[model samples]
Target: MLSQKAKYALRALMMLAEAAPEELVLVQEIAERQNVPKKFLELILLELKRHGFVFSQRGRGGGYCLARPADTITFGQVIRAMDGPLAPLPCASVTGYRRCADCADERTCTIRKVMRRVRDAMADILDKTTLADVRGGRVDEDLLATVA
Candidate 1:
């Protein structure tokens, strides 16, 4: 399940992706445009900045902008930044894998096997889909085929 914070972060990033190159967007403007709470957005933006997704400028004409090109930024990266591992369970996580406490044998665990497949499928799509693809509505045929 996607958290409210993650949703807001994606919305904010999409807005940044749509901006002119090197354009610095004010937090207030993003909050208003995206219908996100200003205070909450400030915290979210700060976290994103810490994660290297965005860069913030201080003082007059100060604002935030993408730290890298939108096409270079994957949805998986942003989601992981905002929500940690993409796997449904710790044991299924590729980046933050851990054995399930109840599982006696991971290799033979049916639940873990299914979950690992789920995680891989999700990662396949999310990692390949970038902010540019989403913003431009350019759905990859291969992705659609994979999903189907």
Candidate 2:
């Protein structure tokens, strides 16, 4: 399940992507526009900044903007950055793999196999779908069905 924080982060990033390049958008504005709490958004943006997904400018007429182009930043990167690994189980994770203590033989674990497939499918979609794709207003029924 996607966390509200992650959803807010994605919404905020989408807003920034739609803005003019290098345009500074205040956190308050994003909070108001996205209906995300101001304080929580502040923390989310700070985390994104640390991850190189966004950059902030302080003082007068300054705020936050994307650190790189939207097309280069995928949903996978943002989600993984904010939500940790995408795998449903640690044993099924490629990036954050950890053996389940109860599982005696992971090599033949049916549960792990299914979860790994789920993780891969998710990664395939999210990694290929960029902030650019979202910004383009291309939310077709097919896309929605696939993700859903």
Candidate 3:
């Protein structure tokens, strides 16, 4: 499950993605449009800006916009930036792997095996699905085939 922060971040990014090119969307506008709290969205946008997902301008007519094209930013990147690794278990993680403390032999651990497959599948889908896919308002045919 995505954390509330991650969900908000995605919502905010989606709004920005749909904006006109180079248009700066006000933070208050994003908060109200997405139904996210203004204060909480400030923190989330700050974090996203730090990650190079967004850039902001100041003064009159100032606000935030995507640092790169929406098609280049994957859902996995945003989620991972907000929530760390997508893996359910540390032992199953690829980027943030940690051995189970109680497991004497990870090589034969059935739980790890199942979780690794789960983690891989999740990564595959999220990493392939970009904000462009979402903004297009239709499922990718290839992705739909894979899901089906």
Candidate 4:
């Protein structure tokens, strides 16, 4: 499940993605436009800046902007930055893999196998879908149709 923080972060990023390349959007403006709480958005923006997703300017005319092109920023990257791995379980994570403490044999674990497939399917879509794709409504319709 996507956390509220992650949802807010994505909304904020989408707002940034819509801005002019050199435009610096104030936190207050972003909060108002995206309907995110200003205090929480400050923390979220700081995290995103640390992850190199955004850059901040201090003082007068200060604000935030995408650190890279929106098309270069994948939803998977943002989600992982805010929510860790896309995997349903630690043992199923390719990026943060850890054996389940109670599992005697991971290779033979039915749950892990199913979750690995789930993780792969999620990564396949999220990693390929960029902020620009989403903001522009360019997501693969056939894929969405299949899912629906």
Candidate 5:
């Protein structure tokens, strides 16, 4: 399941991607615009900044912005940076591999095979979808609502 925290992060990043390239937006502004709780959004942004996805400028006209161009930032990167692993099951994850202890033979497990396919599908979609896609308003909310 996608946590509310992860949702907020994606929504926030989407808004930031839409922001003017040279214009930094304040955290409070993002919260208000996105309907996100201010304090929680603060922590989320801090985590994003820590991950090199965003940077903050302190001052009256300061807030946060993407550290690099949106086109270079993948949805998978943001999700992984904030949500840990993209896999539904540990055994399904390529980046954060963890086999279930109960599984006797992961090599021959039917469930493992299905999960591998699921993970591959997820990786393909997210890796190809960049923040630029979000900023350009190319998001198919229908696709996002699939796992919802």
Candidate 6:
């Protein structure tokens, strides 16, 4: 399941991408346009800024913007920055991994093989999807709005 936090971050980044080559956009504008809560979106944007996904400006014209071109930033990078890993099980993850204690034998477990394939499939998909795709309408913007 995608966390609300991650969804907000992706939407906000997409907004930033759309407005690129323009100046920064205020938090309130991102919140209002994306339909995300102002306060929560502010925190998520700050998190992204801290991770170099974005840069912030403070003053009467204070706002946020992407640090680089949208096409250069992959969805996998944003997802991992916002939510750790894409894998369902930590043991199957490459980054931030933890070996499972009760595994019959990691070398021979069929489930492990299946999970590895699942993880790689997920990674391949998300990695290929970039912020450029999100802003260019190649990816569905309604994904964030569809959360129940």
Worst 10 residues of 1 by lDDT: 134-143
Task: For residues 48-110, write the lDDT of model 3, one tens digit per residue.
Answer: 999999999999999999999999999999999999999999999999999999998999999
In order, the Cα lDDT scores of the candidates are 0.91, 0.92, 0.94, 0.92, 0.87, 0.84
lDDT of 6 at 70: 88
Model 4 agreement with the true structure over 34-121: per-residue lDDT tens digits: 8889999999999999999999999999999999999999989999999999999999999999999999998999999999999999
Candidate 1: where are CA atoms >4 Å away?
Answer: 136-142
Between 3 and 6, whose lDDT is larger?
Answer: 3
User: Considering TM-score, which of the candidate structures 1 and 2 is the better prediction for this target?
Assistant: 2
* TM-score of every model versus the real structure: 0.93, 0.94, 0.95, 0.94, 0.90, 0.89
- Number of colliding residue pairs in each model: 0, 0, 0, 0, 0, 0
Clashing pairs in 5: none
Q: Quick one: best lDDT, which candidate?
A: 3
lDDT of 1 by residue, 28-143 (tens): 99999999999999999999999999999999999999999999988899899999999999999999999988998889999998999999989999899888887745677877
Could you give candidate 5's per-residue lDDT for residues 36-103 as a string of tens digits? Answer: 99999999999998889888999887889888888898888888888877888899898899989999
**What value does the lDDT take at residue 34 in candidate 3?**
93
Q: By TM-score, how accurate is candidate 6? A: 0.89
Return the top candidate by TM-score.
3
Worst 10 residues of 2 by lDDT: 136-145
Q: Model 2, range 60-140, lDDT digits (tens) per residue?
A: 999999999999999999999999999999999989999999998999999999999999999998888888888946664
